[model samples]
Target chain A: MHTRTIEILVGLFLIAGVVAALALAINVSGLTGSNNGSYKVYAHFENIGGLTKKAEVTLAGVQIGTVTQISIDADLLVAKVEMEIFSEVNYLSIDSSVQILTAGLLGGKYIGLSVGAEDEVLVEGSIIEDSQSALVLEELIGKFLFDKVSE
Target chain B: MNISNKIMDGIASMGRGLLDNLAGLGRASMVLVHALFVWPQPKTSFSLVVKQLYNVGVKSLLIIVVSGLFIGMVLGLQGYTILVDFGSEQSVGQMVALSLVRELAPVVTALLFAGRAGSALTAEIGLMKATEQLASLEMIGVDPLRRIVAPRLWAGFISMPILSMIFAIVGVYGGALVSIEWLGVFSGSYWSVMQGAVDFYDDILNGVIKAVVFGFAITWIAVYQGLESVPTSEGISQSTTRTVVYSSLIILALDFVLTALMFGDV
Candidate 1:
């Protein structure tokens, strides 16, 4: 091939490679726009049960936000989970319930939200009052065995 | 000869071999430092780098794409089978994507590059040496290191990360083809879950770093072997083989260290 043609092809190749890297970053890894236009809300749980930061915060089986931080509330002796809810989801009632739930049988943990009937709406820095801690399978099994022995 | 004399001779030869290997390593490091640190004339080197990029990067695209696709398809098929037992077939996407982006793309691409471009580089420069072209260039006031070696080295450095990214992107889609099309995996979950699982900084960027490092090491070894060859046909063949072998070993070793540093908790 001609030198000019080769140079053009090489240029195209580089552009394509860069485009691929961008796709991997944006499309595959979901790198951008993750926390944009989002408001923070806190929920306290007795046990988080392997719930990690960046885990999905879903409502009605659709993701609405992500878990931003998980920390221990020393005063309450509970897990204080911080979530970034999208600005579009600004209608969550103050009394809305959040539960730490697992996906599938052996999948990741996420926070599931159920809207409540209330006039007040949750805003930034609002604490979600109604929260259910994640179920520890080992505890449940242990309780079941103890009940069996008692019986 | 007595047994003691034979034992001493064996130990002396082994020590000599080790010393020779160490000297070779030191020389190779010097060549790499010179090639990288000493900037060539930018006016003419642009075209040289472009030419080398065409030869190294564009020529190697076919094998990378084909291998990436096949490897991803196989991963999908195998991952599905294993995950099906756990009733987590939807995770096949994550499995394939994570493996390809984090490990397979960089590692496998480097191995293939060592075999394909690395050996070719060794042989080409070895031939140039054998034909006294490099020597003739030196006599004519042209620095062969600046004109030839530097361009090829830069080409290799630039090509590797690009090639690895292409390999990963192609592989992910190939995996999707098999999992979503063939195995009846839900397409939405396959992609969404993968996106959720793969971290841009931890996985993709780290993988790119690995690719760049591998590129530098492989190209450095190739050119060094070529320049140091005995300037004969037999010597050229030996150097080519050594280039491939050494590149592969170094890639694997460096990969382990990089992975530990990038991914390990420690």
Candidate 2:
């Protein structure tokens, strides 16, 4: 009876290990899949300090895709962001504008897109127009403090 | 001599003792590595390594799994509560995953394994020494360090990585289940949060390295204490206690060093 009990325990442990392994593999695959042939769009930002790779790009606060890569263009001195938008959200028009947004007053940065009602849909490699740069928290705080000093 | 002179003399003596111990430790480590490579015949030790892996890694799975689940759940609950105050419940997945992958899973699982298996190893080896089995092996020209200690060391190192991987996965699952299933977190946002939270190679490699270091410490301390045991039963018991205490301390110290080295400015 004791031997059987030990065997059962060992079996349960093995199952747990297998389940855990599968979960991790699934999560990893999910991340990799997020970078597939999902269409890319570029947004220029003056500052994107808290903005990171894989940060969600949301339409109406609903995630349409994620920021894949970010690089500063030396000539423009602007941060150019590459995003992967899902095929389902391909209805975004070429006149659509992108904004770097925050969840709240002290929240991580995300991309916000304002949909334009133009008949034309955005091409895969098009740049988002009417873009707003990231709202730097420290600069905003400094501005607020500076206003108080001047007043 | 004056009191100040006596104090200086004592300080000088302590410094010499520290240097002497360090030299001895350096030589001993070199010998241990040499013995590990040369003494164990691959033909015979292959099966031994497999058995030890099963005993060390597979055997401790349950405790690690259960502990990991609870740890994840706790992290989710606490993180949700704090994040919700700021109305950011969606970020709970990222917070939970980051904590589990980077810190909690590896350290907690290693400590748990050390408490369980490390104690058992110390006692088993101490008892064998008390019974003079080690001496008998020595008389027969059997290198006990290679045969017994090496297997335990290898077992511990392998077990730690396996257990850590288990812990990280289970913890993430537990967090996801609690937040998404129990609470009303959106499936879309939960996944989005997790995407930013985990890096495949970075997190896994960190966990594996921490586990390997932990395993080495546990087994090394256990075997060192066991080998130093006297024939008396009391001495054996004392050795076992010292082994567990020292191993636990070393594990914590090494965890800090490894974390700093792996992820700077921790």
Candidate 3:
């Protein structure tokens, strides 16, 4: 029984360690912004590969905000991605574009927003005119492999 | 019989055995369900859980920690070798972190725990049955399932994630150390790449959830096999072997399922 008590205490510490790790992982991104009232915007994509709710959403090569939600729009037949951008970042002009881009070959995809030279800023509810979906690397690899075989 | 006939007979016998085991599994599930409802009071069950926690968690820590260090070092070495091909050897940190958090840490830690704590749980319970201790408990109005099995289950479920986290942390550190000192990568650049590669919550939650599922599978199979032990010593030994094998198989299967559910959205 005495040995059992010691073991149980050790077990609790193990659990605590796991919980600590998870907490650190969740809060560790280290990307924080000044208190700017950033408005919400939604982007529609066919597929946002491996992009989870807390994924980073960037504009003009700079991370502006994070993905707030990802849901399927039944009426529109598309993936609706909601993102929150800081209000102070003024680079998102009217003609700016959003593209789902990969970090590297096997890394997670993030929304990459490129700025347009337009003078007017995109207001809330204004959709970015042009967007590109993620390129499925596996599919591309398969195509290349098959093409080589056929050739 | 001739060779072909003998082979066919063996296959048929194996199939029959599998079917019989499936039927037995169904019966065991029923027994488990019955045991759950008729279990003893909450206080006793809690104590059982406490006892299990000690056995599974505390006793397993040192092994988990040492395992973590070696896994980390290997991951670092392997990742550096590949990254060097692309002149991106500094990316070893990220590679080590991703590999450990995403796959190796959870799997290795679970395997270790299953081989150690899981086998022990099965053997102990099997021995109890073989010695009629389980029956004796019942005779004294003690509900063995709630007291003995439930705690072990809870202990396993709790310990797996904890052990996995320790493994990942240690592994990443080990990888970084090897990459810097042995591989001669610039420490600053290596760490920077790792810093960029890992996002705290996104990467960390993946391991935690995987560990929890692993814990549940290891304990459940171990305790279940143990509780179902026959009276003979041979029966007890057989159950112990089965518990270890089945627990490992279940762990791998669960890893696939969880990975698909969690990361397959891409």
Candidate 4:
């Protein structure tokens, strides 16, 4: 090839490579670039189990938000989860409930939200009133064995 | 010689060898520092860098893409077999994507770069030295390090991360092809789960960072070996071999350190 053609090819290669990197960042890795479309909501559970920050916060079966932070409510002795719900999902009633649920038999934990029937919808910084802690298998097994022994 | 005398001689030779290796390392590091810090003339350097990029990056693209595809497909197949037993066959996408983005793409691309481009660099520079071209350039008041080594080094450094990213992107698609198309996996869940699981900053960015580090080390080793080789055909061959061997070992060792620092819990 001519020197000019080779140089152009090289230039194209570099450009394509850079574009691929950007694609990986944006498309595959899901870099959304901003949090302006989301509002914060809080929920507290007695035990979160393996639920982690950034875990899916699903309404019905669709993901509507993510767990932004998890901390202890020192006074209440509960695990406080801060979620960023999409602003479009503004219909969650103040009485909406959240439950920690597993994806599969052996999968990550997520918070499933069940909307409530009420006139007052939850707003930014609203604390979900009804919440269920994650299921602990060992505790369930222990209870079952104890019940059987007692019987 | 007596037993003690022989033992003392062996100890003395071992110390001498250690000192020689340390001195060589110091020299190699100096070569890297100089190549990095010294600025070559831009008007000419840009063209030089482009040419070297073509030689190193463009030439190596086919191997990178092919290997990436096969590796991803293999991961998909293996992950499906394992996760299927657990009744989470849909997670094959997540497994393939995570493995490629977090570890395989960068590491494998770097290893291939060392073998394909790094050895070639060593041999090319060694040949130039053998033919007295470097010395001739020096005699003409040209800085050979700035003119020759710096551009090649920069080209290698730039090419590696780009190659690795392409590898990862292609690999993800390859995995998708196997899982969603051929294996009867739900396409939506396959992609959605992968997107949910792989974080840009934690997984993709860290992988890119690993690629960048590997590039810098591999190029530095290749150029240093070339520059330090004896000016003979056999010496050039030896330097090329050393470039591949040393680069591979350094890449693996540095990968462990980088992974620990980047991903390990304190």
The residue-by-residue lDDT of candidate 1 on B101-192, one tens digit each, is 99999999999999999999999999999999999999999888888899999999999999999999999999999999999998967887
Best-fitting candidate, measured by TM-score? 1
lDDT of 3 at B169: 77
Lowest lDDT 10-residue stretch of candidate 1 chain A: A27-36
Candidate with the larger TM-score of 1 and 3: 1
- Worst lDDT window (10 residues) for model 4 chain B? B187-196
* lDDT of candidate 2 over A16-125, digit per residue (tens): 65666556656832545445557888878888778998888898988888898999988999899999899878799888998888876666799999988898988788
In candidate 2, list every pair of residues with a backbone clash.
Answer: none
Per residue, candidate 1 scores C-alpha lDDT tens digits across A21-113 of 998998779788656699999999999999988788999988889898999999999999999999999999999999999988998898999
Clashing pairs in 4: none
Model with the higher lDDT, candidate 3 or 4: 4
Please, what is the whole-model Cα lDDT of each candidate in the order they appear? 0.93, 0.78, 0.77, 0.90
lDDT of 4 by residue, A1-151 (tens): 6889889889888897988888887667767778899999999999999998767899887889889899999999999999999999988899999999998798778999999889899899999989999999998999999999999
Top-DockQ candidate index: 1
DockQ-superior candidate, 2 or 3: 2
- Model 3 reaches what TM-score against the true structure? 0.66
Please give the lDDT score for candidate 2: 0.78
| Residue A99 error, candidate 2, Å | 2.5
Per-candidate TM equals: 0.90, 0.81, 0.66, 0.86
Task: Give the per-residue lDDT of model 2 (tens digit) for B1-266.
Answer: 69999999999999999998887577657645854676568876766666666666777877988999999888878888888888889888888888887788778887888778887787787888888887789899987777777787777766676688799988887888888888877777777778676776676567667877787777777766676667688888888788778877887898888888888863
Candidate 2 chain A worst ten-residue window by lDDT: A28-37
For residues B1-266, could you state the per-residue lDDT of candidate 4 as single tens digits? 69999999999999999999999989988887887797567899889898999999999999999999999888888888899899888788889989998899999999999999999999999999999999999999988888899999999989999999999989988888888888888786687678778898899989999999999999999999999999999999999999999999999999999889988873
DockQ of structure 3: 0.20
Worst 10 residues of 2 chain B by lDDT: B27-36
Name the candidate, 1 or 2, with the larger TM-score value.
Answer: 1
What local lDDT does model 1 show for residue A28? 79
